[model samples]
Target chain A: MTRVRVDLNISLDGFATTADQTPDNPFGQDWGRLTTAYVGTRTFRERVLHDTSGAGTTGVDDEYAQRYFEAVGAEIMGAGMFGLHEHGDDPEWKGWWEDEPPFRVPVFILTHTPRPSIEMKGGTVFHFVEASPEEALARAVAVADGGDVRIGGGPSTVREFLRAGLVDDLHVAITPILLGQGIRLWDDLRGLEAGYDVTTEAAPSGITHITFRRESRG
Target chain B: MTRVRVDLNISLDGFATTADQTPDNPFGQDWGRLTTAYVGTRTFRERVLHDTSGAGTTGVDDEYAQRYFEAVGAEIMGAGMFGLHEHGDDPEWKGWWEDEPPFRVPVFILTHTPRPSIEMKGGTVFHFVEASPEEALARAVAVADGGDVRIGGGPSTVREFLRAGLVDDLHVAITPILLGQGIRLWDDLRGLEAGYDVTTEAAPSGITHITFRRESRG
Candidate 1:
């Protein structure tokens, strides 16, 4: 079964992105503070940063971090998340992730200006497409080959997928901080827990991870 | 030392109160759902509901629920919380808590129309005063007599106290539910975590308890 999944780091006040971003510092200080728990995870170090050394936390947070990467055959993200809005018309710019991007699958970037697919190292291919969430999901699912489709986000993109009820599994790592400014994740998602079996676990690093898995509709 | 404390049940989307309130059902159904974890606790069962059967959850939720009713000499709350606005000038309305009120201390009601103090059976005296958050805190602190003053909330009252930097301890039980409508708890309190030492714990009942204690400014 190909499940649609989402994982994000949000503040206790429900902000997923930081407002303290600048031209120089694209992801502000609050972003670091919010994602501290995820970044400190062993799986995050190994997967995202490609840190080969067996360092970093291998606790509950790492367990969730490990789960985030597993079973995700394809990813869909917004143009802003791909830094296309920032690096406009720069054909050489291939996103913040260097040669070895973490996602080792076909990543569909939702944008009007669909660029040629750039195949990075480690089996990661960046495919730009001008498609709605449903269309993107279909593309992702077609290529997923029975693996799960992950709605890899920068908040807004994830929210659209959530609003459409396309998500089957959702996880949010809530850092114990309040960034009063940023893109909020739960703006119009009232009564979102009706169809999902929700669960919460606190990490020692002060991150409360809440998971919502959609039960089979009987 | 007389510390200023606050405890509230908020949704993951930051709503402290529910929107599904009618004249007949003042609290509404969402209120019951939001407080299910708290009301199911042993301490809440004994203290608030006065259940002597010793039947309820005695887990992390109970521990916090037990602490909520402790070390409080006085409570400061809003007029709405006291149901003053709902039952205007009706002498019989002693509050939602029928006869045996929860707080066994002087409860200061922040209102424009100061009425005669109502003394309930269980040492719970309701004093109405038209004062600001600081002024109410001063009155509460004076009567507290070396005991901590708890800002018993309706959300707005607690936010006022928090904005004034008068709160020493703030604990919020983030119920894993998205309430699309109602009063938001976190607003304009940007960089609110600067002085507080934050911690989080997840309860078995799917509640994420986040505690923020004011660290020494020095």
Candidate 2:
């Protein structure tokens, strides 16, 4: 079985983004520490950002970044993270990460509408799949081979997997910012009975890098 | 006019609660720096938990907490925050809060099912209203008099308010933790064209307390 992993940045008060989310402030400054964590390490930054210069040398954050990037094979995300036309009828904008996206592998997006697969300059290919989480994971896992399957999300997509007990590994870079009013990641899931073992926990800079493995399912 | 506010604790990666979200890890962690924020200052701690000591101190967190307890004449929350149900149909669980909840005001819970209002010890009355956000906010605001209406949510409730532009002010206390694979607050709200101004930012602790005022719709 292919291990499924999740990695994302979060604020201290547990907000992924502000309530009135706009292009200007996406994750809000609450996730500043995570952003700092990303930029702080030269090797991790270079690998993810396509500017490969440093490697092997170890730092606190660099280890986390390396582990996260290495564990995942392909990425699966929700369309909301890709664009924004969630409520209203008008569908105009794409995503904040325009043109050249960050991911090097093929990225699958979960949505109701259908859009053409956009292939960016790098190995980033955005495939809009209107299937369920199982199908998406199947495709991602197949592509990942022996590597891990990663769920890239704003929150709902993650919950979809967690509710089904499909996730295996988890990595969260917790920043120390709070958006007193915005979207929250944990509101929809309240009664879930999943147990996670904290395999790794390190406070690099200010953000804590914690990794968890899902325990036995009843 | 009466002011309304929301004071929530979140992890650095923006998870208000952990992924597994059980009664044991209610707020998560035995006592990390984040959990300590809830009972942090001796004076404020006494007032909230014991209802004494923290009468008139005004640190950033104190000011923030005061904003919630003082200005918030009434509040609106979700079923997830209210309680943990065994079955979606089960009616035993009321909420994770103790006999006397933290908020000593009128709290209107937005639920799909109908239930009678449960008035607690302090001045807290939980009115389970099976209405829309607009309806809930209207009722809450009506009860608020001049006080601002605080949207105490898990995430969906806040998103509804943001989509409706009914919220006036938002204060987020971004913590430094993350449940990367749970529900996300900003999942379906990626493309809304809303704007806000960062009015105040104070880092009393490592948790930078920030306030974002939504742009006027006029």
Worst 10 residues of 1 chain A by lDDT: A209-218
Instruction: List the RMSD of every prediction in angstroms.
Output: 1.8, 11.6
lDDT on C-alpha atoms for all candidate structures: 0.91, 0.63
Task: Specify the poorest-scoring 10-residue window by lDDT in model 1 chain B.
Answer: B209-218
List, residue by residue over A46-130, the lDDT tens digit for candidate 1. Answer: 9988889999999999999999999989999999889998895899889999999999999999999987999999999999999
- Candidate 2 chain A, poorest ten consecutive residues by summed lDDT: A185-194
Clashes of 1: 0
Docking model 2 quality class = incorrect
Task: For candidate 2, give the lDDT of residue A148.
Answer: 72
The best candidate in terms of lDDT: 1
Alpha-carbon deviation at B46 in model 1, angstroms: 2.1
Query: Which portions of model 1 show Cα errors greater than 4 Å?
Result: A216-218, B215-218
Model 2 Cα lDDT, one tens digit per residue, A87-130: 32444444565666666678888888767777776677778788
Poorly placed runs, candidate 2 (over 4 Å): A1-218, B2-5, B20-27, B30-33, B42-44, B51-58, B84-94, B191-193, B199-204, B215-218
